[model samples]
Structures are given as structure tokens and as C-alpha cells.
Target: MTTRELTTDVLIVGAGLGGVAAALAAADRGAQVILTEEYEWIGGQLTSQAVPPDEHPWVEEFGITARYRALRDGIRDVYRRRYPLIDDARRIDALNPGAGWVSKLCSEPRIAVGVLEEMLAPHRSTGRIRFLARRRPVAATAEGDRVTSVTLSSEIGEDDVTVRAGYVLDATETGELLPLAGIEYVTGFESRAETGEPSAPEVAQPANIQALSICFAVEHVDGGHTIAKPADYDFWREYMPSAWQGERMLSWTAPNPRTLELSTREFGPNPGDDALAVDADQSRNAGDSNLWIFRRIAARDLFESGFYQSDICLVNWPSIDYFLAPVLDEPRDVELEHYAAARQLSQSMLYWMQTEAPRPDGGTGFPGLRLRPDIMGSDDGLAQAPYHRESRRIRALTTITENDVSYEIRGDAGATRYDDSVGVGMYRIDLHPSTGGDTYIDVASTPFEIPLGALIPQRVTNLLAANKNIGTTHITNGCYRLHPVEWNIGEAAGHLAALCVAEGTTPHEVHADAARLAAYQAELDATGVERHWPEGRVYAY
Candidate 1:
């Protein structure tokens, strides 16, 4: 109804992990920042999306930025200080509160929200960083080659806010600001001829985006906590994906991402496995063999005896992946419909588990499975947002293709080294089933570099790709879209924006000039941003 105007040195739209990292980095560098989020919580994948970090093998020791390490440490310290952990867990340096196999540090999403807020507390207190929650970007004003302002409408029916900034960062999931700003961006799959990526399809399928999953938390306990059957239960239960080899979508049996084999995963709630023995090394073990321990967030054995009646396991399994439709670049009503369908799919999966899912001991159903809404910070028990694996990528000066990172393509040469490298990340090319009826396109990849050119759009003068929206092809997006990589991308974008503001320069200018680029990278080095991997320490896949 009403309009409000605000100005900042840096405006980050989307308070996800990347957006939060960007805000902190910009604010720490003495830039006035305005960070906004559509959700009530800030952390994207960690909080709103409710997906644990899928990190590299060396995550505990290296290959991450200093700020990211601090966030991880903060998560662990939260459990050590507040939660009732056992003596061994309390003493261990890297105590996984969730003890989830997906990541080294998997805990409650709300915990990540607290840690992220605390990380931005000092900046917020000093008025350097202003966080606007429950605000979604609706419009943008671009002047020739620059985004002058972005208009955000309030979700809670407050006044519409227009943010004018020296530099704008598109950190939203699905790259929400790209189209609004009239930026040149690509969505869905690129053609094999277009990208020369082996994994790319023969023809470009713009509507064939990766499957989005609506995650939820559940714990097994006494008594029946069976939820009402979802309306689409019959449709989902009877559905068998072609790639799944006749396995029902709601069942525990599904095709493995890497192998594509019909792997039957085991599920048993409160199976008192030694939580301390969980070695979450994905490179060595995919860890999805057991649906229960695969993403167990809170192992009861990790805490004091009887502190937890059952292990809190997050349901982000393959069974719940919603590939029926693409959520991005659709009409508002259509997008909402897809999201509702995704929710139904997740709920249907839960209902199936509670009613008809096959047990390890030849029984059927685990009626004791209870949804934990408090853990996810949602009333309906589902996550605040869907886990989006891909985003609208900006057409940049340097687009990272599968040829650059694929281990099979590069061989002993390692990944393509970047002269304008801003950071480093590593993950396999892990594309899930798409709306185009495509199966998983998983491929081993080498540790890769994030070039400054990837962050800078080809035509946009003041806007930066701060999340999975960088100059990465659909094939390469799989590896670059992980938690640490996204954080690094955002951090680099924020720091670059701050540096540009301080230096009275544009991103293109800094990137084109070798000296300026080197100086900017030096600042990143000083801040503990790993610009390059070790000379000999290269790991494939």
C-alpha cells in the first residue's frame, strides 16, 4: 500500500547462507549493507531449506573460508554450551550434534539461524548492516547497464521498500533478481553443443530444472503420531519413476545418485548405533545405504542417557524429490501450485513411512514416527523453503563448463586453473532427476576455482551473482551449488562490492586490470579466503 525508500553501499537480496555471508563480508569491510530475505529465517539451505551441508572430505581441516569455519565452529559451540551432550561428545573438538552422515556438522536448522544472527550481531548493532526479513523482491529499476534499485514487497503486508544501492547482489534462491533487473541469465539445461559438456543434453530444455525437495524433521517415539494422509497419497504412492526401475517413489528403494542402481536403503528409527563412530566422508562412503542414519540430526547416544528418546532424523531422502514440475520462471499461481505439490510429496512420503513402508524386520510402518516442527521452525513440520539445487545463472565473462571441472575430462591435468580466481570449492557433478524426465547426471569432478569473472555479469555493471546464480553451466552448477561453495561465492561478491565502493571502481574494471584483481585477491587472502588449492593436493570426485 505505502512505499519506503532506503539506500546502502551494498544491497544483498536473499538472506540465505550466501546472502548472510555477503552482508557480513561487506559490513566487515566498512560498507553499509542492507540484507533482505523472503523467509523469516536467514540461513537458506541450513535453516529455511532444512538441508545439511554437503561438504568435501577436507572440510574439517581446510578448503573453506575463515568466516565459514567460524560458522561451523559456532554451531558446534552451541551444542557444547547449551545442549546436554555426553562426556565424549563434550570433549571432542568436532562434535556433530546431529551426527548426520551427510556432513561433519549436521544440526538443527534453527541452531544455524541463531549462529548466523549472532555472526551478524556486531555489524547490526553498529548500524552497518540492516536485515529486512519477510521481504521478497518484486521489481527492479535498471539504468542502461546497471541495476539502480530493487523494490521489495512485504510478506506480512507492510509497506513496500525500494532499495537503492551502489552495488546489488542476487543471492536469492532461483536467482529471483536476475529477471527483475533485466540481467542476461540462463536457466535449466544447456545443450551439449552449446556448452560442450559431456553430461549436457542434446537439446536445451529450459523448463527441465532439477527436482526441488521439501524437507522435514522426524523422531521415532511411543504412540501413534501418524499424520493425516496427504490428498495426493494415491498418486504419489502408485507413482514409479522410469529411472527408479519400478520402485515406488514413496518407498525406501530408489536409484543411487552415482551408481544409478536400484539400491534398497534400510530404515530403522532409534537404532542405537554408536553416534561417535559416524565418519561422514562422502568421498569414501555415499552413506545413503541407511535412510535413518543417513541424515540423523540428533543421535540420542551423543547426549546424556535418556536425554533424547529417539534420534531426530531429517527426511531429505530421494523419495521426496519433487520433479513433476519446474518451480522457476513460471506464473505466480503455477509456482505456488508446484510448491504445494512438493509439500504434498514430502507429506505423502511421511504418511507412507508411517502406514505402509516396509520395515527391516519384515513388519510394515513405523507409526511412532513423529514430526518435529519445533526443530524446523515451522508450524506444518516441513521446512520453511524448498531445497533448490539449481538457479538461474548469469551469463558472465567466464562461464564454468563441465569441461573445466569434470575429473574424467581433465584427467591428471586437474581442473582448469583460473588466472582471476577468487576462491576454491570441490564437489561432484550431482544433478538430480529433472522435470524433463531426466535421470541423475552424477560425475566425478576435480577441486575447482571460482574466478572473479564468473561473479561479474557480462553486461551488468553494478550487479553481482552471489549464489548458485554465477556463470556456471547447468552441468557445472551441480558441483558449485553446494553450501561451502555458495558461501564462498557470496563472500567474494560482498568483499568485491565493498572494495569497488572504497576504490571508486566497477567490478569489470577491477576484474580486467590484473593489478587491481591481484590486490583484491590479496585482501581475500588476508581474510583467509582460499584462492587456490594446494599444488599437489588434488582430489578427483
Candidate 2:
């Protein structure tokens, strides 16, 4: 237990998008900030998880914060500056990548991470920001009521660091720090009787939550240069289900709101770097071969040209998820075991693609499906972390429940009338497959406000939640779990911490002080964070 000590105005645990946003926001407001992450990578879902961001279509014009919008634009700038756009793509453009709901502008995950680092450069140079990568919080020191310091430990090093700050933000993937800090946190799910959430399990079982995905990239190389098979290829080959396509091999599935069942399609493309014209209608019209392929590979041709090979494939079919029931309660070597399982998941998806996917001529498995390790890099051609849709939510002053904000119950939205709005989030109600049951739970959502109370924990005087783990119910979590919304929560938390340090006021006081809270809302608004939806189509989500 070798321990060292340090001090800062604010300390943040976890360097995911939310934590990163918090660090940047607080530091920019002249607060010294120290942030820690378990992984070497910074961007959580956007980078490490290989999740081509789950951004709303209108984000470029009006969805999230100015900071978030800047980050989004930065990703595009990277592509424009580094890659090449084809003549047609460049010429007739309203070029949104993936032709899907998620990322409007898609690029390699690394690009997003690089841009995030650049955004924090000025603050780092000024000593306002310090990144303690590969470290986890060991303990949280509190005095009377306020958090005084936090001890962080790194597995590789002998020395541990203690961070003292006015405010502490918990952005750990699983609310890892909340427990260490003695914060009141909730795990798994609450029973339907408890929260009255239709989606909540009939019985309360917190551990049975959504499973994580370990995604990878691929390329359809011409000729016979298919990549070598993954190490645990057999386990993946045997993974098949009645609900999936082609023996549960490479398949495309999206949550259909009308049917509540996943509509899956078999996807395969020949000669990796090919281009298909996709329109706003979500229609692909590159003629026969494209209609034949219609697969959502990283069609590099969709990007601005000069990007060397507009030909990398992204493997995110629903086939490879590390299902929850099987490994949710693995008591032995959980992290390592999960990693092993996750890798097997990615390899399994690839195996399914390579050796089991359904081809156009009704063939099973396109052995030509190659894993481009160099593209996604070292963490076994997959992301360094798993795609986490839900996590340990804190028991806060106000637990945002489905009754307060679910599309199924609201018909519109439950939390549409938030007066203490710090930010707003709007997305289709999208509950991913959970161990409780396989339910998409997709429904229309009214643009809703995020109450500041949801971000503040009930017990921790100085600690706050800055990720999807914010005080949302299991049901409401579906709408608030996307990338931009998490960034909004984090940015607001950062600004809140800065305000607390400056005014010597606790989050509770600020909430109580309508005058001061209004001022804070003003600041957030001036920073281009929408506390309320505008008076038009924007409001009509």
C-alpha cells in the first residue's frame, strides 16, 4: 500500500467521454483538475469500445453542447485533413457516414481519442489538468461532509496517489469509485413494484443487466489473403441461436420499433474498398453488387478522399455480444475472465463472418472476412474496452424513473417539464438486450430535460456522477445512455464543480438558490448546452 499525495481543485475518476468533458470544463474555468482512467485509452465508447459514436442526426446543427459539437466536428476535420474524399462523395454531399442513426461522421476510433487529447492540451500545459492513466481509486477521504481526498492505485506501479479536491466526479464504467467513497449506489435493476417501471424485472435483480460487446474491424481483401482464424475459433463457431441469421454467424440486426424484434440481414462485400451511394432515406443504390453487399463496412469511400484506403470493415453484428446470464456473476478472476470472454466474443463474431456468415448465393461464412488488426490495433484487433450501455447507477436525491421519463409510459416523455434543467437528452427509447430479458424497448421520445439533482448523489457531499450511471432508472437509462447525453452530464458536472469551488456552495445550496441556479443555467446555456429544447421542430423530437 505505497501511497503518495497530490492536491487539485477537482478530481475525476474515469477518463471516458463524460470524465474527459468534466476535466476539460473544470480546467477551462480555471480549476486545477486531476483525472484517472483504468485503461490507456481516453475516449470511452467512441474510441476504446470501437463504437462509432451513437450521435443524433441533428447534432451538427443543434443536438448537444458546443464542446460536444466541437468534438464531433473535430472528428470530421481529422478525416478531411488526413483522408481523401472521392470525387462523387466530395461533389454531391450531405455526407453522413454509416447511413444509419448512430454516428453521422464516422472514422477510426483513434481519431476521436487524438482529438480529445488535443482539446485538453492547453489546460495540461497550464498545469490545470493531469491525467493519471491506468490507475483506479483505492479510497475516498471525507471530512465531516465534504470530500477531502481520494487515493488512487495503479497495478503496474508501487506508488499510489491521493487526490484532494473540492469536488469529485465518478465516471468509472461501473461506478467503481462510488463504493470506495461510500457513496449510495444502485446495482442491477429495481423491481417493477419498487419503481413502477414496465421494463423493470418482475423481481428485483440488480446484477442481471445489459451485457457488453467487444467490437473489431475487418476488411474484405481481394484474392486469397484472408486473415488467420482467431485462437478460440471453435467456441465462436458453436454460438448460434434461433433468433439470429446464418447460424448466428455474421448478421445485421437493428431494433425495430414496430415489431419489437430485431430485423437481421446477412451482410458481405467483396473487394474491401468499394463505394455505395446511401441516401437520407436509408436506401443504398450502388446498383446490383452494392445491393448484394449492402453491408455497413467502414466504407472509407464515404469519407473525404485522400484517406488512403476507404476500405475497412466494422464488425458489430449482434452475434458476438458477451451475453449476461452466462457470465454476469463470474466470481473468479472477473476482469480477466470477462476479457477472455470478450475477446472470444469478438473472435466469435469474426469467426462467424469468416466461416459461418450467409453469403448472397446462400453460402455460409465468407472465409474472406479478414480481421484488420493494424486498423483497430493491439488489443487483439478489438477495442481496449467493452461497449457498456448501462452501469451502476447511484441512489441520488431524485431517481429518474420510467414513470418520470420512459417513452412507453409517457407516450411523449415523462421528464419534459423539468424546471431545474441543467441539460437535455433526446433519443429513441433504446433498451439493449438485457439478461432480464431480450427486449429492445424502442419507442418515440419527447425531448426531455436532465435535472441537476439526478447528477448529484444523496449521500456523497462532494462526489457526483458524470456518466450514464447518473441517477436514472433502469427504464429511463435507455434514452439517456448515448454519447452526447453523457458528455452533457459530464460537462455540466465539471461546470458545477467549478461553481462550487468558486462560490463555496454545495450542489444542494446551488439547487436551493433559485437565483444562483438560474445563473448557473445561464452559464451552461451560454456555453451552448441546451437546458430546454428550442421552440420548433427541435423541440418536437
Candidate 3:
């Protein structure tokens, strides 16, 4: 066995949105950064997990990081330059490539990769940033409360690499570095008594983490070929839960997040409607009734007639959400089992759709739905990573609780304002079915601030949290775990690390000293990070 070693000013152990943002932020500040990812892709949720940006309505005008907006514009530019879009579609100011109702910018994961790669190209070539894909962190070297380095092994049989850095950011999906570094963290739901969240369970449910889905992409075809039956097809075919209102997990009958009532979603080839006509404001309407174009990544109608033959759609619906077991904090074998079962659940879903799904004409199945592994950069058709909704969050200097952002708690008063806000984000408290057999716990939430204190771990002097693993409680995590928010969090973490490195201080010192905190906030402001919302508040996105 051979060992490799590398050193950098900052180390980010995840190539997700946060990791990418963090790397860029640190590199921009002249700090050498090393970013690693378990998958071949760089963008986590945006590229690897295949989930589109779940953003606020005002995203186009304001209330997001400049880099994030750049990413959005880059994706739109990709469509304009590469795809032969309709004149009207191409000219629209806020042209949604896929025009999927789920997001204002529903695009293919591959396009995101291209844009991200271009963003990091300069830094990569100049040696300001070194990105290694298919590297998984296996261990961490901790000196007392600080993480000195991380030991990672190649996922593709390369030599083990040990990376030493002044600052280590846990940007990995699910906060994989927390436990490895012996960082104090919390998992699953914190009891209402602990977090004072209105919707929290009476008792702590360690195994009650939100479900993760193996998102995949598919395109409609005219052929009748269907995917091979999944090994666990029978298990999922008849699967029923006491908390669910549906007969089976595969049907259109699923519990509504807001009302918890049985609801049915219609699936079809295309609505034959204008993409501009589809209003994507989930606050006004969930916009989930139409499944085919809900999160469609490639809309053939928007392009020239012969340009595209099929409308590619990402399958990340409720039917395939796997919550039978919690993947984190479990035995290694158990975690593997949960992941395997989750993939099978998605496969079973496709099989069910192909063989037995009820069509509008009362047809049995639509075997023409062809899986597109190329879209997701996966040979097995599954997403590079599961769509994780929750993570092991650090016990930070400031923990965002349900009371801070909950509309039920704050009402017309709006979410609590933070003086040390580093960025801003908006989304509903949308918790999917969990391992504890709980149904969706979606609730309205006001636009919230991302406090810099949330990124600073309480005990770890040098380690920082840059992803969904920040100091957000289970209930609050629902709203904070979106694409833009995670990016903002990572960006903030990166800037914070750069500041600390430049000042010869720790994250704790920055938070503790009023002067340093103000300076840090000023840096964030200068970096085009939106730290607050507009005066007039209107929640629709």
C-alpha cells in the first residue's frame, strides 16, 4: 500500500455546491484550497444528486450570492449558446431551460458541471485550487479539538492521500467528517423540549432522519422496452406504511405535505403549454400536479422541432423516497443496506411506471420511459449521490431553531433578524417521510438569514461546517438544506476561513470579538453576499 500527501491552506471534503463555493471563495482570497468529492462530478446537489435549485421568488432580482447568480446565468448561457431554443424562449430575461415548474432554472446536471468547471478552470490551472474526484475521507487527524488533517482513499483504487490544511471545512453531504473527527454533533430530530420547535416530536428520534431518494433521469420514447425488474420489486410493489394514505408507494395517491390528505398527481408526455405560462411559485401553488414537466430537465417543445426527440425528466418524486432506514450513525453494513434499498426503490418505481402505472387512457404502463444514465453521469442510472435532506449538524455557537424561521411562530412579524447574518435564503420547512414512519411535515417559513455563527463549530477551533451540516436543528434543516442556501453557507464558510487564515485567528475569535465580527461581515458584503432581505417581503418562490 502506498501513501500520498498534500498540504493546502484550506481543505474542503466535498465537491457539492458548498464545497465548490468554498473552494472558489478561498481561492479568490489567495488561499490554496484542496477540494475532494466521492463522485466524479463536482457540484453536489446541483450536479451529482440531480436536484434543481429550490430558490426564493426574488432570486432573479436579488437576495442571493453573486457567484450563485453567476452559476444561474451560466446555465442560461449554456442553453442559449448550445441548444437551439425557440426565439421567444431564448430572448426571455429569466429563461428557464427546462421550464420545470419546480424551479425557475430547471436544467440538466451536465450543464451545471460544465459551468462549474469553467468557473474553477482558472483557479485549477494556476494551482490555487486542486480538485480530486472519487476520493472518500476515511479518517481524520485530530489534535485535541482541532482537525489537523484528513486521510482519504480513492474510490477508484488509487493510493491513499493524507491532506493537511490550516482550515478543514466539512462540506460533505451528510457531514461525513463530523464523526470521523470526533466533532460534537446532533443527528435526526431534537425533541421539542430541546429545540422549542412547535412541530418537533415529543421524544428524540435518532432514527427519524428525513428520507433520501436515489434521483434518476429518464426520457420519453416510442418503444415498448422496459427496464429489468428490480430484485426488491415485490417488496416495494406491495409496500405500505401505517402513516401513508396511499394503497401502495407507487401510485399517484400520496399524502399532501401541507394538508396530509390523499392527493393524486397526473403524469403525461407533455402539457403542450407555453413554458412561460407555468408559474413556479410554490407558496401560491405547489405546482406538483403535473409530474412530467414538474422537474423536467430537457423540454423538447422549447427547442427546434428536430433538435430533441424526447423530453428528459428527473425522477425524484415522493413515491420513490426511501425512509425505511436511517443511513447515518448506523453500522457500516446497515448504511450500505439502506443505500442499496433506496436505489432499488427508485428502480422499482421506474419498473412500476413502465409495467403497471395507470395512464390517462387507463393504460397499464408506459414502457417507453427510457432511463438516461448519461444525463446524471451514472452508468447504473442512479444519481451520483442520494438526494439527502438532512445531515449530522455540528453543535455550533449559534443553532438555527424552528422558532427562528417558522411562519407559525413568527407570523406577520417575519423571521428573526440576525445582526451577524452572513447570507440569506428562503424555502418552506419541507421534511419528507422519515425513518420513524412520519409523513411529510411541510410548513410555511419566512425568509431567513444565514448567521456566521452557525458555521463555527462550538468546540473545534479550526474546523468549519460549509454544507447542510451547519447548526440547524432538524425542523430548521428542512428550510436551510436547499441549493442556494447550501451554496451561501459554503461561500460564507470559505470567506470565514480565509479571514481567519489572514488574521491569524480562529473562528471562535471572529465570533467573540465584535470588531473582528464586523470586519468579517464587511468582507461578506464586499463579496456580493446578500446578508438581508428586501424591506417589503413577499414569499412566493
Best by TM-score: 1
What C-alpha lDDT, on a 0 to 100 scale, does residue 238 get in candidate 1? Answer: 97
Model 3 regions lying over 4 Å from their true place: none
Clashes of each: 1, 14, 1
Error of 2 at 324 (Å): 3.5
User: Cα lDDT for residue 463, model 3?
Assistant: 95
Instruction: Estimate, for each residue in 50-127, the C-alpha lDDT of model 3 and write its tens digit.
Output: 998898777789989999999999999989998899898888888887879888999999999999999999999998
The stretch of ten residues in a row with the least summed lDDT in candidate 1 is 532-541
lDDT of each: 0.92, 0.71, 0.90
Clash count (model 1, backbone only): 1
Q: Estimate the overall C-alpha local distance difference test score of candidate 3.
A: 0.90
Per-residue alpha-carbon lDDT of model 1 for 444-470, expressed as tens digits? 999989999999999989999899999
